[model samples]
Target: MKDQHINRRDFLNIVGITAATTTAALYGCAPKDQKSSGSKASSPVPTDQMTYRSFPSLGEDKVSLLGYGCMRWPTIPSPDGKGDLIDQDAVNELVDYAIAHGVNYFDTSPVYVQGWSEKATGIALSRHPRESYYLATKLSNFSNYTRENSLAMYRRSFSELQTDYLDYYLLHSIGGGEGMKTFNDRYVDNGMMDFLMKEREAGRIRRLGWSFHGSSDVFDEVLALHDKYHWDFVQIQMNYVDWRHATGRNVNGEYLYQELEKRNIPAIIMEPLLGGRLSNVPQHIMMRLKERRPEDSVASWAFRFAGSPELVLTALSGMTYMEHLQDNIRTYSPLVPLTDEDKEFLEETAQLMIKYPTIPCNDCKYCMPCPYAIDIPAVLLHYNKCVNEGNVPKSRTDENYREARRAFLVGYDRSVPKLRQADHCVGCDQCNEHCPQSIDIPKELQRIDQFVEQLKQETL
Candidate 1:
């Protein structure tokens, strides 16, 4: 117990703030320019030809291989000190920039950004002609299981997106054990799939598919039914890390792209950088990539890895600022597909990246409302941030970290008055089923609980 008590000074010595600050500086964390109200100011559009990737299964039109994921929108100080708005002005500018640069795809969902995603996405894309870009969203039927509820959720997407038709519509996240049960209950048992197919025939949905999270066996079953439905596209968690690792029970011992390739289904790649994990590579890996491509940014390596093949239809990245948008556009403007040597190097690097064993939470916020009121995602995020900053020891000692944990746990305790803490998960293995990243949610929570308890003892 005494050994576990890491002091602030010693922790800082191990994980230097200077390195983290340097990393942030090199990565470009500039705030985006806000658009003016009265005047229609000319925006900075890309002068170069945007790189494109074709979805032959859907159409001959080539979309910018880099699609913008409108999930993590910018937040501002709330007027009432509660929460933030969607930052529409900045979002609109990003939309404008992406469209101008030939990025024809924008992916959103009903659950993203506290349920404001569809509305914000609608407002932003409405500024441009609907035909100029393709819009992708999910069914997000996690909260609703019955056919009536599912249909309502689907219909709500149309109104929120401000569109009569959906270019690409996914079944949200499919795979995890509990998620499979929910899928069976909502779509299968309730005949939601039958309704969706009819809607597709009615032209409301141009392409129909689902995003996958776990179990390759389940993926196979879905593919087996694909011939009957002719799923136009499928989205999968396909970063360099998950390619080789066992992607939970639902993944069926196969990489997502491999499964898609087997079915000839075009794969829409999500989390190319594994939720910014790949973006903040360790110094050794960073040096390796930098040595190879001196001018390329750290993010460029991720895009390069994702853009390596022709099988991938779209690689979605959630860009919060204009510079991130610009940098991504530059990476994809003249897309450099990775060579064989590059692929080999990235594969090795990815193997090394996973060795750190950070929690697999992708910040999807599905396991939120932690009946105990815990800010599960925030806690995990802070943990990962500390790990990446090489300040895990310091993170254990820092008052700020302790405060964040305390605030989150206190909030959780208040909200979910009857629920148990992370320590009380009981290993029922219930929540793991709903997770998109296939995280052992209860296990991680227990670990955090243990650490928190240990911290308390140390302080005493």
Candidate 2:
């Protein structure tokens, strides 16, 4: 809740507002070969060029540094054209390309993409030799943690994934919501953790760990369980910005990585782009990065930072488009680890990014299927996009006020359907618990709704 608002006067003083310079182009929805202005021209991505990492605990598993995150698979209009559906054919192509290029790890969860991710990922990866790639999924017993339900969910992952053995498994999105109390209810109280430990012992699950997004207290409490449970690996959100300036309840990457390194636990990275925020930075920040390394994509910087650490097993990217996949491949296909001076430069850039009043929504869609049908990620992402573009009008008297107002309203309507807009949020706070970022969903939606109202009522 760090002042998610910016007056025109304050913004004008913060950085030279420039409409001429735009942030990076959003991919996935674009054509296959589309290149973002912030990225360099496409170069050949070699099949044998990917960097690999491993530890004694992982045995002979040589994991690729570039892991494919199955959260944002490409989608096509459903046959009925009413809603979207995962394009299985497109997924197959992406998977084939990734494995050919040496990406050996695929991560998904039962809740991603409205619960279609595992099935689609399973379908795509099943076509390849099971040994060609490692499959990872989560228990994801968020709302229903009963012994029966949790067990059913765990078994269903195998059915959905079409795999007899899981290479890596996680306690899906632990340490959020009510913190350790919630964790206890989901894993400890229901005896799910013990069941998973037995599953590991039985060889059904080769490696077991948890992905964390909670307070430092919860992190410490869970990490302390290492002696008993002996976590095989841990997934954490790490990037240049979050290395030090993590918003919300997230612990800094510096601390998270250090804790894992001390225990010799390999760290799997998520949100290397901070939910795409690092790739799509503010215009001024983008300029500084481009000046430093004009050939690299804005995203490559974040990937390099995440992969630079020796403790990281792999860094995951949900590449829905071929271009994004290619760009990321070019980056890690033999990663040029950042120099100490480069790290210093990125830290300075991170400080500049923190000044902007953008919402830290990573568009994870965990808070989706809103009870009221409000498009939560759409609402928040649209607002953040406008903030980066300097199109959020704060006052009628300000210069470019008319343009900004029109842009915000028009873009809001286009980005979010009228029925799904922020004004419809009744503040039930249901989404509050699901968000891994610990966002106060109702409060943010209400604040945005009020702003929209003021804009609508303005006469001038």
Candidate 3:
């Protein structure tokens, strides 16, 4: 009910800017080896070489500093193309590699990868000894907040994961627009809160918490109940860029982390790479970090930032390929928490990044099939990539405009198929309601489409 929260909400409503891309690629990996999900006996990673952070609340369990985010499992193109099939064998190999490399925690939700991630994750993890690792899943009932339905979804998480009990469980995305209303219908009104808390007491749920995605007001509300709920942990979106400038609908990571820290709560960091923005930044920015550590991947810097904070229990990354998995494991296998000067340099880098008009699209695919088949995230991501590269064509008259226009157009056509490009948007708005970032999808689609048309007419 605070006016400030409402004001910020209104500002977002007016501009309708959508940010982050839904999909990302590992620049240095091949999927050929991933064609099959066969598990291999990965070489052991020395215990000292792997990073582990403990949460006293969870007892002697020391969570791996690098938690596997299971949302972006590799998929095979469905024969129909309307629905992609997860390559279960590929997923199996990835899990084996992660566990052998000392990753013990895996996080997934019911809605990830079109509800197939949990099953894929389950099959892979179940192959290993149960005591070797931990499992986490969610009650991601974004709609239909009925008790009956919520309970059914909660139970299904266990069934799909092939686990009798979950090491960690969550009330997913509790702080989007209408967060309070949704929370009430999904938890309080339906008595789901009492039911879940009881599950924790009974050990079926070893630990319980939620992932926050909106205003500080909503975050405060949940923490206020900590005395009764004893929330074992909290997941938050955090990165160097978002640590200070949350930009539109997001609660800044600084505030979110501080609040959790005040209560002695362990923080689970999400979006550390800012949906791949930090790793794929403009070359100038990349050079600043490259000058410091030429051998490290750009992603290692972001992951280290997330891990540096004393209160953070673990940082999550969605490793879709072997290269991604290997790189992250190497980074965390021995993380070097940032120094004060290092933090300052990152803060400066963030300020420079803000000048670019890149859209923040996490490519969660919450807004998909576009009702009109527009690949909304991919188009915006392509545009953002160009922006970072200083290729946003402003005029055909500019000296480098010809080169810039070609870069944007060619990248757009390649990244998104002609059939699914932004040109096809019908503006039905079905995708908006699901966007936690509250992006005005139609507006972004139109904006990008206009740019695409201009390039086409002027260049060709």
Candidate 4:
């Protein structure tokens, strides 16, 4: 059910894609669609190019404002070409460069990268002195939810990550599945939630928090208990477009942030780019940014908006590529904090963006390597890109329908091969179970295939 604030037409913005996967993820592993079949070495450079933030509560005061999210590691095709594996060497180089440039916090979980993100993160960061950086991992027990398994997962993160003491520990995607019911089952009923609080008291877990993923009611219920648990930090999805325009069961970032501020809990931001949609915007909208600062990237504005807030502890970006790392590092080195005027201009741009019906998929490639050979990201990306280009066909009677029809169909064919297109999906729904975004994979494929068939049957 939608939140009370969400009306009939209040499109739940980009974050709406999350509902379906959370239930599938409760078992802790979701099958994601693989994107491509190539990976290469990452080059690491030594330089201090990041800004720092103070999290006095965490005891390490000089936390780099930019935190590395290890969910999207670089991958190379396996020997069989049927699968992809994490490029550990590339992961190391990226970690080295990030630490060399002043980034200190590294966040990972058990389920990221099919359960290898922590191991890869450990191997890379372990070479450096343990004290040189802070490690954050989670008790990510979505599937096989049991206190026994939860305890085992906690111990395993330390074993795999090569650390005895975790700098920051999270409860992992709470409010997933059936919202409050799932939250109670995973934490409250299992007695693991209280166990975690005691672990923090022991100093083994330095910081205790939870990452938000479901409804606003769940967010409120958790935060309401702040007096008893005293959450050190909470992670939430915050970006320019999501501040006031959030759709679905989730509330706006502005509201979430303010609630945190009122309770004096510091914030950790994820999806600051809204799954990369903010970075790859419409051309007319891109011009608005270029007019103001030609040198800065389109993504930096979103980062600045995320960073400008006073209570934010650090903004996390899953930088899998070397260039992604470099650009983000430079942006934060001396983050030009957003001003009131800057925010006003961004809100105006956001309002204009609502006209285009683009899918919120961040191209994270989490939903890649479709079992049916469907090129999932490519198909969705082409549709979104065309929407930005103003070629989305609404009706056959329209004057631009013929041209729009051609543009979409031709681009769809070129973007994704015929055999791997949406038509190939078997409606098995195995992919949806593993998606972090909760997008109904087979359903979306069915709809896209229908659209393609319609375009073929009509005439201008």
Candidate 5:
């Protein structure tokens, strides 16, 4: 598989074969041939390489501006039901394609792909010389707050990534008020920050920072401490949709990016496509974008948006297939910075996007293995999808939307443990701190639970 080169036909066929099984598992439906149903894998749209953007703050690495995020690696069948394990062969090919085309940075973490990300990233990156690429991972201590656990997680990241040094290391998923306290206790009080600083001095860690998931206040508190710590770079959720949405303090009339810029910190962007939501736009949004650039893929718009600024250090996308990697490379190869008019249109679109409020989870899976066995993120994702499609009925009299609601509700119940349902949200708010969108996760879960109850009662 290392030497294999799959052509477009073979690639399409592989996608066709796996699309059914993977989509069904992801969406909780029986495998069906949906290729003929208007979701056909389109050919790679061509674009020049001059359109890509780069950030000087990152030492002028000439990154594609669009990075390859490794959280959602394509999984194969396994007994544990988490997509057996990563398909290493496919992964290697994807990485190679991205690197060959000047994508220098690859971002992974301890929890991505159920703890397989680091190992897979190691394997994929080991194929190339160390200096040829830059690697990024996070000190993901979300599950364990003790300083010991945090240190162990960092060491494990080193071992799993098969490298002695990390190009960039971040505190993963910082969110929620209480969760912020946990961060303070775990790192600030427990000497973890001092340890990371020492690691940076030892050259084991190049740049030190954190990825954000809480409100503007949380962001402010962290930045306020910056004069003391002098963080080299920070990662944040930045996308056209989230640019000024209800989450990210944008809806509350706060500007997240401006705050970062104010402090002179470079921002590593996550969720540039909003968990792939922006990759494939609805017909209406698609029409508007196409009116401007008819030949572009829906995803190109996202890369363009990210590249429009020089402040963004790197924009990450989870590329599972070679073609997906290739498409992203083409989109960013010769970056197209959005014009001022394009920026205004996107800002307006962001306003329109808020009308359909989906759970802000990026599917990072920081909140996993719900003690009660609920697939919390999966349930939220499906519900969000239904909302984005406008399949939810305003009134019970709308049978079509109502039926769609029933299908999703019944499917949710069948797919997740009853105890694990959103109703089980103990208001712990543990998941909220890790979410970059600053969603009121427990509250949203409660709302979903109530909606499910109403749907069940209606059918009765």
Candidate 6:
């Protein structure tokens, strides 16, 4: 925990800010009035070395290459001794630490963390000057899309974030379910898009955009609206694995980025770690990533790739703990953009991952509180883990079939409660619409459930 800050000359040179204008220009929206008492220990990461990106549309605002995604704030036991609560004190500490270390972009939504992320994020960020950071939220009107309901959600974001003007706003998780029809119902037909455009014009929403997931047709259709609506930025799932190997109804990250790039729209990247999958990769893949930069965490490879593109405004990471935040900040302190050779290596790695057949569930828990109380993410992740560990055998004649079967069954029960296991999924397809990765939750659960049953039967 070295507290030694980077030299002033180097800081100014890296950020390209002159001494006279540095304070006003760099700290315009990024200065802290006070430091948190809890983090008095010196940090290994230098505060002044953070890499930032600014575009013509952003005006004087300079956004950090690493944006804090508020979907997975840390939690603690409730004061009332009930279930867990968002550890606000901890949230404040993490936010303060991030701000001190040069992370200024905070993205949240109404639906995240069962609807508490925004309030928590707002409270932590409100401690700093509004100019100290950029606040971004979304109109998460998933179920109720009436003009009235949509407007209420939009207004509530400002209240929750404690900001009158949003630096960035989005139509959250569009292009899923019924695709364009769903998009129309959510934004177009309901006049929400018109209302948001007006809000942007009025300066309440400084940058307007959408977080996309679903059909290529809907994606193209929405991008086409850029001429009329003028999207300020777009959030898309981009990472080494998803760049060319996206599953289900999702389009490749390359295609999505190219579309936004052609439109001159900056991309705010989500899922740079592929929902934490990249961090916890298969053993061999981990070796491949480490071979290049053994000093960097496996997750840093994905972060580098996401930030390498010129059009990427920032790569959002939903870091739940301090270590995750620190590692990501270090990666982007001065992003080492991947070269042509690095890109080729990752493309090959993506092809390797495609053979594993892991479900693309990012553990977002958008499909939680399953009607049957099934733990969708837990079930899917447990299966993926076994695949990575070589504990999933394809045939009974496979050398480790007996050991693999035992390991999978034992680990499955330990990871997911028997009652909450995949067998409980009733194919209701209710979770389909909520999944950002476009995972067919019911289908995957059913398949895993069947595999578990087969393992059980083989022993008898």
Number of the top-ranking candidate, with lDDT as the measure: 2
Candidate 2, residues 1-460, lDDT tens digits: the string is: 1222333334223322111111122331223455755435456887888999999998898999999999877665444434466666777789889988889999999888778888778877877788889899999989987999999999999998889999999998878768899999999999988998999999999999999998989999999999999999999999998999888899999999999999999999999988777877788988898899998887888999999999999999988877788888888889999999999999998998898898888778788778787878878887887887788898778899999999999988877778878999988988988899989999999999999999989987
Error of 4 at 246 (Å): 0.5
- List the candidate 3 regions with Cα displacement exceeding 4 Å: 1-23, 26-48, 80-83
Question: Between 1 and 2, whose lDDT is larger?
Answer: 2
The RMSD of every model to the true structure, in order and in angstroms, is: 11.8, 10.1, 9.8, 10.5, 5.9, 10.6
Of 3 and 4, the candidate ahead on lDDT is 3
Query: TM-score of every model?
Result: 0.79, 0.91, 0.90, 0.84, 0.80, 0.87
> What is residue 75's positional error in candidate 1, in angstroms?
1.8
Q: Clash number for every model?
A: 13, 0, 12, 16, 15, 3
Locate the minimum summed-lDDT window of 10 residues in model 5: 18-27
Quality of model 3 by C-alpha lDDT: 0.79
Ranking the candidates on TM-score from highest down gives: 2, 3, 6, 4, 5, 1
lDDT of 6 by residue, 248-304 (tens): 777899999999988889999998988767776787888887777767877778899
Question: Which candidate comes out best when scored by TM-score?
Answer: 2
* Cα error of candidate 5 at position 37, Å: 13
lDDT of 5 by residue, 330-410 (tens): 666667678898889888877766666666666666665455445667667767666666655567667586667777776
User: Which candidate, 3 or 4, would have the higher TM-score against the true structure?
Assistant: 3
Summarize candidate 1's per-residue lDDT along 1-460 as a digit string, tens digits: 0122333334323321110000111122112453211111233435466777776687865677898887776544344433345556666677877887788999999877667778778877876777888899998877568788888889999988889999899988776546457668767889989998998999899899988775666776777788788999888777666667634443421366777787788888887777766766666777777787776777788887787667888889888766667777777777888888887887788777777757766666566445444446655654565455443444655656655555544443442222334555566665665677667887787887786576556541
lDDT by residue (tens digit), candidate 4, 97-156: 898888899999987766777877887788888888888998778777799999999999
Misplaced by over 4 Å in model 1 are: 1-46, 178-181, 246-254, 369-373, 394-433, 449-460
Give the distance in Å from residue 278's predicted Cα in candidate 6 to where it truly belongs. Answer: 1.4
lDDT of 4 at 435: 57
